[model samples]
Target: MGISNILEPIQIGSMTLRNRVLMGSMHVGFEKLEDGVERLAAFYAERARGEVGLIVTGGAAVCQEGGMGDQYCNVYMDEHIEPLRVITAAVHEAEGKIALQLFHAGRYTNQDATGVESVAPSALQAPINRHKPREMNATDIERTIQSFADGAVRAKKAGFDAVEIMGSEGYLINQFLSPVTNKREDEWGGDFTRRARFGVEVSKRVRAAVGPDFPVIFRMSGLDLVPDSTTMEETLQFAVLIEQAGVSALNVGIGWHESKVPTIAMMVPRGAYVWVAQQVKEAVKIPVIASNRINDLRQAEAIIQEGRSDMVSMARPLLADSQIVRKSREGLFDEVNTCIACNQACLDHIFDGKIASCMVNPVVGREKEWALIPAEVSKKVAVVGAGPAGLEAARVLAERGHQVVIFEKQNQVGGQLNYARQVPGKEEFNETLRYYRAQLDKLGVEVRLETAATADSLSDEGFEEVVVATGVIPRRPEIPGVDLPHVVSYDRVFEKQAKVGRRVAIVGAGGIACDLSHLLVQDQVVSPQSAQYLLEYRILDAKAVHHLQQSGRKVYMLRRGKHVGTGLGKTTRWAVLANLKRHGVEMVTQIDYKEITAEGVIIRNQEEEQLVQADTVIIAAGATSNDSLYHALQGSLPVHLIGGAKEAGELDAKRAIYEGAAVGRAI
Candidate 1:
């Protein structure tokens, strides 16, 4: 329907939000030991200016022992209150409400990072972190409860509108609630009431400490999403008890650190866990917020309109475009840069102990540094290659009131992005390309298709500035028999220029290799004509569908590294590997390539040398910078190199887009 429901104001306890959109808490690792306060204040202030209903600061550790170990904000003591006030004040100045999420990492925390023994309800080693936690005694339990209350008091003193008790995602409260982690036989475990006691008590204590008037939001896991974890029914029961115990609202999230279910990856469907929030909404009278993979305005609005949730929470979408709410409110949906949930930067960066950034939006965490300002004098700019980098540079330069033109050698824009979209489960990359295209049209950036750019031609055209985003070329490893007709690059396969045989051997273990393997093993029986005529018309039977999904191709992924898909994001690696396994794609790692024969490629490992039987060999070994034009045009014009032309280290879109934007802004 319409987005009126999402734009409508919502109330929780004594606080009234401007809209139903909440910037869900995400760990960005932006906290500093000395001057951390102002950095975070500026970060949230930008989002606040975007007019989000409420901004939930990334989880702030409630106690030193419960800290997340990395660069996380602390709200455990009175000293933290003054520094945190900076964030609350800045958000308030922008007429936005701010909430502090008080968290205890429990078994999910790393002992090496914290330099303290992690504590949980039971002495169990968490599967994901592999951290052995000390079972909480009576004193430790009391202290933990007090820590939550103390954090709440500090939050209130710091001028926070509310305090969200971190109860979900295998945190301290979730650990006690889940049967898989809470294997205790004390008053805090063994039974449903006892197991949920920690969460209930924390909510009650926080509510008491902050007074009955202040809002106390309990972030609950509607379902633990792991084996032997709390079920929907049990979680719903716990929700009821927590509401009665004094929770003003519930922020529902899915899965945990060890959850097998795909939660935030690109493969996960939007609003996949909204049903969990729906069930929780039905069970509790408090406002329910649904989160995880809620990427666009349509999806967020639908969640609220369909009576699934009272509000929608998103972290990645806002990270990609902080103006999501503002833009959507103005009916500028297409202008909004949607999050594709690639997790290439946000979640992956957090896992790698770096500040989280966005793949599509490069100016996420470094908003202050990458702030867009109008140019003093507009100039004619020529950008070579219409890939993500070139397109971004053109868009930014045009936005700065400069005349910009992008020259692409191919018939279409989106350099490798076009090939990227053809890969299985990567159709979302098209959305990013769409954003660039829209921005180009809106900003009046002239695009010339099938036109190769040179410094001589640009100088003849009277272009004042030039940017080279020539992108990359596939790096074919030098080996014997590589000149065979069957040996093709990944680009040929993606462009449908290469005909692959029943048996395929990929010569790389990066993301492209894995994606190619997935593409090769996909069901080949379902033709586009049949899919449109039969499946689209609902004329296909279950047997026919099953037949359409049968694949006869045998694929092998070979790598010199220890692991396949090593270049993949942490959140997506396991899932991609699992898909490869289910499709029976043989992964051969740590292999020394010998030579390619007429039949197959010969390889050597530690034990022996053998031939891998294959009819077609695909070289996805990697890409080298396509900088020949840049090198040739170096002294002719004031040319700035960007994207793959500048560096082809990891083939990361984040770096490409950011570099493009940076160069655009600088010139």
Candidate 2:
């Protein structure tokens, strides 16, 4: 289908966007560095150059007390104006429009970061926050409202194209909108109308301050996805009020931070929350933008053409590939590095209190430092593996005008990522492979599949630089009857080379084990389209579909360690574990492996021996570095090691890709 709807220009208030793609707001933890403003300006300028229709910057705190942290922009302070002005100028110079997102964390604020306790409409304790908030009095509420108005004034003075009032994702305004958090009987929280007064008043005040021409977008929660939250009717009513309050558009956000539903994980289907935005669009005359899990141009175009939304917002996809919009516009969809939504390097890092970057594109936050400039001197380079590390290294080397070749023993690339894609809900890994293939081919990198390059072969090729990213080999744990006919390695199971039985026992309770268990215990594989159809037609409710998604297969996972899924990211571990639990996969930690019998594996937990009844046993203990090739070529040639070859203690694709890119630049 031809792309037309998403590419169409849109007008919001007096600000006209070149296209419907909005680079959504994301906090990258770059707001408080000494040269933070300069870094941020460069970041936005890159996206602007890529021809994104509009950009809404990360939230800037409306007041000190409601601040996310010291790293966030405090618009309440006089010092913020100059920095914001610099950003707006940079964006405008690139011929792009930018919106400043006025923010307040409310009870989500960290006392350690703000040097004060969090304040909210009521003194409710948030599940995600440690600090119980102090209830805001009438004076506090009035002051907070004034602060939002003042922040809008600051944004306009800074030459911003528009301002987005941050009201969603269980922030300050969302707290007032939800009945679960706001228990106050005062004017602010007596009923639905009163509960929504805070956000409406803020929008009204911001509009009053910015004048009618300036764009005022309210990011309202379409569905809190929490218990006893605002109903859809109330949320739509809130949207109507916000529109009446003089907002130019409504950007619909789904789920609260404390909501159990996974909003932006790899498991979430694309455009999963679009219905929420459609409801808001129908409720109000103003344009509505759908957010969350809508990546790529096809999804965006369909959303706009179908009239479900007037626009679409993509935050992480832009981080993965700043040129997503431009590439799609030129019909170079294959070249665009789609966001896998693994959250390994972006959201996971943010939640870990570290600087955020992209797993695929490592140059995201370090754009200036990690630029792939042309090599001063080009040379013939040999990358001795076609996995993540080798693929990236080859791509970068070829891009810098170096003659590059990649050797892989397998018929295809992606290494362990192939297994990852085989797991349910991990279909996005194929995109990584697709991107690498496109990049390598475009850069003229030679790939030799089913051909493993040895030290002698590489030395004979007369390559100046050799990069050894040989990846890793699964560790074979020592146990009685380990090589039994019914026992299989995780790789064999993933490759379908070995047959799994009705009952299965898996060794090692790590990421691989959990994924394998999920795959084996699931009764049927539901494609995203089919799943959406099931829900849309009401053939099966979410709860019933969830029940049907799993099977009664007896799968047991055994781990020697005390914890399961040890190295998983904090944001994704819980969700993965929940899936395992929901599928009835029994995970036993602190177990002593006795032996592998024909019927099943024997384990001793808490000094009690028991037979885990299983027709097949699988081993997924861990991995060891495949550094034999690296060591072989060490003294024979000048070689660099990366990815699993450098460190196999933890299998990390994020570190692998980053290392490959860094090595490529250095060479």
Candidate 3:
């Protein structure tokens, strides 16, 4: 038996994994057109050194002529072989198996590469992809088949253990499979069988090209999850067909990029798509791999334990903490760097043509060379605030073998985190608090709760270094009736028994404001039992109009600016907007607040002035930096103010923690 039974070996055709840990395919964006192969090799080699059982090299485009995105790697031609050889050879040298996920983004291709003349199963254009595809003809189909075969042959020669066909998410194969998209009258359209023909044939050709010994992993959407999309029956049938078409296994996925929510990290819960994998596994004889939000080790064990799927795949989780596997094996799962799913650091950065960085763990993806543990030096350090920044700094300092003490005015750790965790879907942020607490205990850092430190106090203590992590304060908005007992700040919303009326109105469009809206709404939601587990929904039909809307909610937005919610990231923005729109939240932008009365909110918009009725009004405009402690201690002692004091973002948890880690390493 392997560590916690997670390292057990399984077969994909003749290829056997040393362990079930598969470093799922993720775009590193380090691949330049010229240095692509070398960069990819370096990326894979680093993962291989971490003992990644198998490596899936990002999403490699198969046809340079019609499919490619900016700074993306492509194995589209024989010219791409030698460079890919470097990748496979590097992985193998580290005693790891390497596979390539062959991709053709179709309409998802970039305009700069394909000249905007790309084609999907249908001619429908992506809302943001910007590329209008060239519809595929019989010759296009033939060339696509040849392209898959060519890419597969190159994979075999390059020594990939297998090749995963990128068949999900409204890509070419999925477009044909989807009824909402594929409207062609040709043999490739009309029915499920015909719709699956291209994928099945591509698998057959890829297998034939690579010989029977080489495996082909068919990645497909078991359920499109789109409105008016292909049914589950079609997906199951397609799964069986692909299995019989000589594919080694199926990598199950769900939904399309244009669905209610894309990007598995944001919307999907952990094990959110396990049922998809289970359905495919039950429908076919071949092994099935499950992915999409399966981040925790226990959840993964449950999937295999209950026979839901043969293996689990993780991308962002692995990226955030490459040592997760090793740590879990050693019963140190708490030490792992958890993914907050912010998308700001990882997805957004890489997409923006920068190296992928972690929101909290700044040293991520660079662990092979970059060390968060600074050089050996004995220094006494004092970190004030005991918050994300303080703890991160303390942990890093302790790791670097420095004597460190953290001071907090609060009785417990997690300053803002204690409050920030109040948001919906952000309950996991508490994991960081527990992680730091565990680090404090493990590394023996002295934590003095209720010990507020000043520059003079720290100087009297004779510490070598001082870091003021005393975070920010809520910026109070100037408005009438704000001082009344009926009006409470967002921090107080989740702190105590906030008696919000049936008609609740929240002001401000900041992260906390949006989150406070969700917190209040969820508090009002109802969950009825008809089947398995607990359920939840909103009460009073209140939507975070500024954040999102799933169903109709009577959410009132009082905006002081033009855009209601401008500060949110991509994933959060979509969710917030969709939720708000679905709930029919009322929007009143560019409003001057006249007053907050028991009767809703009275404000004047640029267009017109209106007094909306509200049971209660909550404020979430912005935060004020309570720099009194830092400023008082500033010149008095050598104090470095990092994080929120340096920049403004709620996830300053990330900013603060990274600063702490950097300072810890340096000291």
Candidate 4:
């Protein structure tokens, strides 16, 4: 097995996979109704056809009360067995095996939605999961164990090849395993071995119910990633006992629901939990499955080839692109709708009770409803600027049979989007760029680089429609000291202007400031030569709560008012605050910056006057649109201004893609 080699056949109990890829469990809100058999079957079947070796159906609650997490979760009812059969049959038809990961929402289930009392191993409730949980009586515990065993039997009857017991996440089983949540002194708590008793018993009952050949995957968090929760070391030791109880495989996961920086899910890195998986893999001979932000095929292959884990699994990746397996096989990898891990549509919208849709692929859940077979229209069009808006506009127009011409002033296609990929944590921005590049290429759209479109430079275009997607520029504040030698912005840092000193202070709290913080934390800051392209950002909310502030880096979030970071999205805001809080970055909120100098910044916070030191000053105040071209060309045609130019909307992929679609349809 070499590093360049691909994943080979692997065995997990009786069922074997031709490759080591499992279409990880991602609920597209497929079970909104009582019977989600057909919808779920169709969804899994699509991925199977795309060549996935294994399909783990989005979690099915083993019990009705205190079990389900969302409004659309599949139930473990006897009737649900019939639907499970349908899904298993569909996957088998496409030569893919299916596994049922039986789950119990435990305290994570919403009490408001269910109107049921949350039951846990103990009465201690999670701060974020604010449900008044009733301590599990002996009868409740016994019933839960029996219910899990029953669900495994039902899954077997439904034709699922295997069943994985859900112990990962901070669910019922994990809650019992966690010292933070479980405070019981009785049979199920106190000691580490005693704490793991519930999960161990559930596996024992499940194995007994399903018989000897049936493989049971024990899904447990490699690390809870929550304060005072179980770590990977605990998980490793916990696995040894669970394996002794007849577990066939271990499904390694990271973080709990409340954890903003999920161990495996975000923009952290590819295969972030491989080490955790490797640890368990080395300890166990039964094989281990690793899952967390594994989007790259090469990474997955390397994991298997290097024995990091027996297999790799993904949830959101399969939803964003059902044809990922087939596309990868056919070498159309870039064309696959990449999961940017933006929880906006998938988690946020679904929690809000809407269907799961991708920001890039609008036809995610409604793929059957909105699909174009591609028509050959013959209109010639010119798209200005090859940024997200322009790239998307040109791609869609060309797909509709229009002969499109896209012009970008920069050598690269992704304008500010390209620069954003260089920012830490926001690496998902790179995927958005790949999506557009692939989309435009497949549509046969002609992209012209280094072609800056002006009023006079509108040559090679005598078409029916012309789109001015030239994008926007940054706005400089009228403050007098902004023109100083040391003042710079995020754009300059991204462009990599040299001669910037080590210690830096970035001003601002919005997306620009957050990104600069990540960059400055990574030792990338603005220089004097590149100061023209930077932003002068100040903060609005500067309360550090995470360990990111411990990075030994100096970050002073300067604000003129009472609040900072008011513009960040809910989930994104939490992540930024968490990182900033952990890294020991000095935050100076509620301060008015009177001046910027080479040595430091002069500020005013309340009645006190203080000077903050910094070798380089990065500004992130905001951006201004160079919409002069849009105004000049507005009357020449029925033109539309969109995306950032429309309203300083950043490279928020949703805003850009959704707005681009509207512009295309309008045109």
RMSD of each: 2.3, 2.2, 4.1, 6.8
The Cα local distance difference test for each model comes to 0.88, 0.90, 0.74, 0.74
Candidate 2 lDDT over residue span 589-633, tens digit each: 998999999989999989999999999899999999999988888
Q: Which candidate should be chosen as best, given TM-score against the real structure? A: 2
Q: Estimate each model's TM-score.
A: 0.96, 0.97, 0.90, 0.84
TM-score-best of 2 and 4: 2
Q: Which is the winner by lDDT between candidate 3 and candidate 4?
A: 3
How do all the candidates rank in terms of lDDT, highest first? 2, 1, 3, 4
Clashes (candidate 1): 0
Give the per-residue lDDT digits (tens) of candidate 1, residues 18-124.
89999999988878434566768877888888889999989999987788764678887788888888899998998889999999999887778778889999999
Q: Per-residue lDDT of 1-667 in model 4, one digit per residue for the tens?
A: 2323344777888878777788776657766745455667777787888777788876788887655544545545787777567888888998888888888878787777666787888776667666768899999999999999999999999899988888887888999999988898999999888899999999999999999999888898788888888766778888898888998888887888777564533556777778988998887788788888887666687787777888888777887778876677666667877877767667766656666666666556654434444544566777777777777777767777778888788888987777768766777878778888888878788888987776555533555567776666665666657888788866787778734555677777666676667666654233423333332232212222122222346776765655555655545567766776665566667777788777788787777777788888777777776577678766565466766777675555566666666566555
Model 1 residue runs over 4 Å out of place are: 527-547
List candidate 2 stretches off by more than 4 Å.
523-552
Per-residue lDDT over 1-667 for candidate 3, one digit per residue giving the tens place of the 0 to 100 score: 2355566788999899876767777777766535656656766776677665677878888887545554567777787777778888888897778899888877767768544467676777776576566778888888988898898888887778899998987788888788787888899888778878888889898988888988789889877768888888888988888988899988887777777765465444667778888988899988898888777776677788788998888777777676676677676777877666667677767656677767777776555445555556688888888878888888888888888888898889998788767665777777778778888999999999988787678889888878878887777788887776777777677676576665667788656666666665554233323111222244223334223322223556667887766767655577876665554556567778888776767787765767777767777777766567677775666677776755656645667877877777666
In candidate 1, what residue range of length 10 has the lowest lDDT sum? 30-39
Candidate rank order under TM-score: 2, 1, 3, 4
Instruction: Determine the C-alpha RMSD for candidate 1 after optimal superposition of all C-alphas.
Output: 2.3
